[model samples]
Target: MSTNVLPLSKPVPADSSLRLVPDVPDFVVGPGLSPEVADVVTLIGGSATAGRNLAETRRIFTQVRRALGPTVPDIASIREEVINTPAGKLNLRLYRPSFGFRPLPALLFFHGGGWTVGDLDSHDTLCRQLAIATGHVIVAVDYRLAPENPWPAPIEDGWEALRWLSNYAPLLAIDPLAIGVAGDSAGGNIAAVLALKARDEGGPALKGQVLIYPCTDLSASLPSHFAHADGYLLTRKQYLAYVANYLAGQDVEQDWRVSPLRAARFDGLPPTVIITAGFDPLLDEGRAYAGRLAAAGVPVIHRSYADMVHGFITMGGRLPAANRAIADIGRALASHDIYAFSDGGGI
Candidate 1:
């Protein structure tokens, strides 16, 4: 990592006094946020009901489905399938775009639940939106979560699935050249690891890697982790709880399987796009990772929604910025320059 740190240049937005509903997590428009994005902040923040943290997080995810229903696309086709990873068979939900994929692009996405709670169902809408917004076929991976599979299992599952998907791109009517990987939070960790692995191992080449507020480092030292540690939608305590459960007493925090930023090198990883939120704990790490890619001379686009919180990508359809972010993601995925590094024998 470089010695330079990019300090926040502007004054922070969203003082504690923003107007919101008088009860349980009301909506509030704050600094660096527009009205539409505020609606998403209010919706997600107020969705927290009293319960075990995991159950409460699930409730918030459920509330996300109820609140953001308008943005979800009508599924033209859902092909539920599985892949044979070294650990075992893993599930993948394939979303064929509206125009079809007899010869289209493919995005292999992974869901985020801090490596513990999410599944195909929790992220179905997000995948559908990507499919509809980008006009590409999407394969949502159901890699085993931590506490159940742990460490290398999720990483291995993601890698194997992407490999097979790339190899069978023709069968799925996808252009192998246009294939990419995506994920949020823990899933982002997996996607990033897969990118590093594929590049280093000489497996299938990828067009891009999309990381949404990813947890790039496991040391818990980033400023976002401390700044938004509590009551900013996802508490640092809750995060540690999730990680503890995810790790299950394993001291694998520094392992590349758990922390992709620790990878020995980044020169050959895919062109990258990383998304972050202003008030989320994992925000700094996402930004830092983008910088790492840039320092390695990889093409990268880093976006920060300063008024938004963690898990904002899934909330895109309801919020205009989120929608715009999704569109931006699609464009990045479909761009022609992702492979520019390999042109003219420069790589």
Candidate 2:
């Protein structure tokens, strides 16, 4: 971390306003935020909900999410393909950072929209930036959404996508043993679940997992949930709404797949990077999950952006901190020995 702290300079857009709640703790206020992040928070106005129906809400959420950041340009190439899965044909966008003769490490990415919204396009720029920064082939999964496909459907899609990537490594020009899973928010939940599933299923061993402000608990009753719930970009109301739509009619609260923090065991999982925003409602749970992973002897790098709010990772173009966070994620991935040959041998 650098000693220099950049101060906010640009004037906030007239439509935006800082929506900090009264009586916030000094810790929550900590250091002043980057000007760009402050501007985004102002635009968000502390709530992301916009419509009465799921469709309208999704539309609004996607629009807001895209508007928060600028699109990154010039990746080596992007390829779109469909993979057959138990749920359906899953759409995937492959981002190649650079052309190379040897197989490269890869990350199977899931985009965040509370599992109710978000698509490959919504996260396209971020994925490309990450791919370029990390020198990894990034595969963005377009999993089915909620209030429709629901809980286990998305989970299954994520696991299936991971399996596909590992099984078809030669065709994709990726190292089967070097594949990892990553996502933000709901997508993070999916990535975490997929890691667990992979461990239990005993195949396609994951090299690592990068979870950005993941929702580890579906109960949504943590102290952080109530403390920083409203003013953060992701509010308690929006959290509840997404979960309601996702788990509607399902009673899998205690199921580890649905709420990973509730899992009885975290042993034998791959090395992990868990990132959490200081003011996110899901902060405590993410931290708790990291502790659990470490206790279970899994190598874990837990990072918390104490002065930032939820979804900061997606605001790289706007927030310098977000760019730094992305670099941190890249460095974490690079530090691991992902190039080690799998027992199955070279492709």
Candidate 3:
């Protein structure tokens, strides 16, 4: 809520564990794509086609993501529950890793769909994989989508879910002090906002955050937005449409919750890991956010997959980079000392 934007600084060096694929030449439409991803994109028409109404757009995206066949890890258990919130009941899917103790660290995950299309089922595979790789409890929040729920509604649901996890840690078999947030795209926006809210409200201290290709700046004028706006899984038109649907006539471009990069201060945030794909329209903002966080003295690790496109994380079944990225995320979480073990537990 501070109006004073944090001063920008020189780029932070990439984390040692961060991998950078070589950049492809400008002549290429989607440079450096793995064969699997390239084939998938080619089959689906590299960019989201324009002129579809909201319903049609949602249907197309849903079908396309379903076709990706995300990798499903063999977790110990999965359960469904709902968190009671002031606004309404929000659905949640809980995932337990195959090899972790009762009081394990937990991640409250939000899935990406431009905040319109994704659901618990859409991201089921990714959540399971994360639970297994990180050895942490994964709570996938099916937050309300935009144009219907819109703006503060999704944000509110995210906060409520995080609070519920922290408050009911014992019932959930999680360590309250070891919980964090993770999300991709629109979901990433929610996770970032939750981190800000927690810092301001002074409770539910988070261990860390993992934001994958997050839409950090809703204003959306970054260089990458123009440079890689087309021929990537997520296109410029789609990006604008998603924002318009999400904003629903309210003007909150300057609001920190909507645009965390515009926030006045970034201090006191948890340690963080931010991942950005080279061909993602959201790439520059994600990188800028990492720089801002580092400038404010928050411990930050930034990983850039220079050869990939946005939404690659959800294509792990085909993209080796996606699986590798998941593994890197696990290592980052563990290195932060967020995971916990009971007396008889083993890694």
Candidate 4:
């Protein structure tokens, strides 16, 4: 991770296939990425697994995130709760931006760390931001990680969390009718699967989904995955390592649960906002998922930060675009009918 900045150049052409919704005035798509993001990338460097094992990797991942991530914003309230699932106890943190008594729409959020790292604390700042930005109760789930709890465990926890949140909405001052799902990286993968599950299995109806540089395809065969595999923070090697750990020798890359983009149908899923970083390896799949959602008659908002890299959303401390992207997400959530709550004090 050299401090030397890459020479700036003309921005790459925007993907013609992606149809970005122009409703959000503040959420501008990229002609160029923030130079500050590039500086952060240099400061953070490649993967957390370069010379460390799973435990060390996990610790370092959280450490780096906290170091470079955004400052925690003040909120009206934040509370933690425990729920039992098939995999055992799961932890959820709820963030509220105001003390209003009105029942609010909620977003069930999962953190990104390739499913091997990240927890409530790792994503606390982002969740808080969403709470302020979207004017929704942000429920951040501490899903089980990989290697120790691979494949279905994380998604299993997510499903249970979604059901738990919806079933117990009133108690939490949340509107059961306005629930949605969101996550970044591996967590994004889970959110997408949960949206599909809510559609196929029925119950806990979802209003929308916001996937931030989500890993919609675990196969890692997409062209963007290769094109930006190295140099960027999320390298090809690190990504494959995370995939291997999550799979744990299981041959389920094609499974819809493992890879939402591999799902047979996308027609009935909720409205979606897919945010992709131009330099991220997962860029193509995120864009592909957005395209598929649009083609299937689902409302879709696809925005590509042409100059940003993978994991920029969490780097709000150093990246202005990161904060802007989050605000855009808030606008997207608010666009859904169920999310038409009071303006409150949201971003």
Candidate 2 lDDT tens digits, 32-77: 5566555666555533463456666566555555555545557777
TM-score of each: 0.81, 0.87, 0.86, 0.87
The residue-by-residue lDDT of candidate 4 on 1-347, one tens digit each, is 11111121222122333211112222222223455654555455644544556676676666666655566677777787889887788988888777665787788999999888988777777888888988888899999988798988998899999999989988988888888899999989999999999999986788888899999889999999888876677888889989988999999999999999998989988888889999899999998999889899998888788888999887776677899999988777656444544532122
lDDT of 4 at 48: 59
Point out where model 4 deviates above 4 Å: 1-35, 336-338, 341-347
* Predicted candidate 3 versus true structure: per-residue lDDT over 281-336, tens digit per residue: 99999999999999999988888998788888877655678888888898877675
Candidate 2's displacement at residue 154, Å, is: 0.3
lDDT, residue 115, candidate 4: 88
Output the lDDT of residue 13, model 2. Answer: 36
Q: Whole-model lDDT, candidate 4? A: 0.79
Instruction: Report the C-alpha displacement of residue 297, candidate 4, in angstroms.
Output: 0.6
Best candidate per lDDT, number? Answer: 4
Q: Residue 313 lDDT in model 2?
A: 82
Regions more than 4 Å wrong, model 2: 1-36, 340-347
The clash count for each model shown is 1, 0, 0, 0
